[model samples]
Target: MSRITFEDLEALDDDDFTEDNSEPMDEEEQDRLFSHWQSVASTHQVSIPAEMAGPIQQMTRQSNAREPVPFATLSRHEKLDEVVYEERMYPAGKWACVTKGEELYEQSISMAFMKLMRYICKENSAGRYLGMTVPVLNEIQISKDGKSFVRDILTAYYLPAEFQQDPPEPLDPDIVIVQREPVRVVTRVFFGTTTEETISRQISSLWELLESTEDFLRDTYIVAVYENPGIPCRRNEIWFIRRDQ
Candidate 1:
């Protein structure tokens, strides 16, 4: 009887939608990621400086190929409408993560990626080298510009929440069997979005937009971000992988 706007459709009364996951925050992505970072920290030497995070993320933000753009210059959706995106958050590490896992062929790499990710997310939510994942079907290759790469891996069956206690899914047999590539060597953050689609076409659109630009997209360090339930996080961040200078 009443006209429901897009925003209205996007929003429903709290009473209308009860929380799906039972133990929302208790055993989710945060624990999994932080745990991994914690384990890796003992092996590394240098500690991340406190103030460097802001600048590091700023450096990673995608800018215009021709000229510099201000953060204030664009609206929020304008920034996120992209299929593939780059983001810089705290902890200073950067990444080029995506949303989908089904696009790639060899799902094993995805498993390895997840294993490495859980190690980080469970160990250090606040450390260098955050974990993130994006969906791509093409071979993950480093670019001539030396800033981007395209690799594909199949990641069968992803858990929407609570990864800390969850076992690694998508065993070798479960995957579609496409192609696999080692993750680029970079320090990164894993930000993901539940509202987003991780399928190949969507990822391709994201990839194409970046590919057209003078800036390169190679050795794309893909990280997967699982949003916290309580936080207003539906979509996630996908920053480019950092290259060693």
Candidate 2:
């Protein structure tokens, strides 16, 4: 029989000691922790301070319909075709809670959901908001007028979700601080006007604007809020971020 040397024994000891013993997170554990919080939020019914409710509702109404016409959008679709468009930036950071939409089918659904989250955060409160972190590219659908915007508001727009075999995008949850502000959008398609040409043009323009403005990214997108789609108007937001870097 071969005798093990001190070094060999030490190596064995180290291997035994270093094995990662961290338990995998099971669904039960996740639910146990999360359910408690759910109960809390549900019980507390954290109402937006009365002062902030009107703006939130108005902003929601606006997101559902009415954004300034983006003359610059016409020039966008004329540019890039299939790529994930461009990364856009806003002036300020906002806080958000990511929520999902009904009958979600793709990761884009979740992305749009988080995007809405950011918008909702801004609209809900009058004061600045510093919110969550963002991860990946979700889906996007273009719109032109109020009726379509309202449709998106009702339908919850494009769903932001992950694809099968795809990893969940990383987000900072409640880490980086941000200052919340309004957001805007512009599109060419409207409710009952889902023309390929119009949707294509408006979608192209929005991507272009995002590409142009990415330098101002506060950090990462907090979340995509779902707005029932079908309201209209070219949208854009005057925004700002107020977190100490």
Name the top lDDT candidate: 1
lDDT of 1 by residue, 165-233 (tens): 333332222322222222332122233222223423334455554534423344442433332211222
Q: Write the per-residue lDDT of candidate 2 for residues 157-232, one digit (tens) a residue.
A: 2112211122222243422222334333222222222222344444445445454454333322122222221111
Candidate 2 structure, TM-score to reference: 0.21
TM-score of each: 0.27, 0.21
> In model 2, where do residues sit more than 4 Å from their true spots?
1-56, 60-102, 105-126, 129-245
Sliding window of 10 residues with minimal summed lDDT for model 1: 62-71
In candidate 1, stretches whose alpha carbon ends up further than 4 angstroms from where it belongs are 1-106, 113-199, 207-212, 218-223, 227-245
Judged by lDDT against the true structure, how good is candidate 1? 0.30
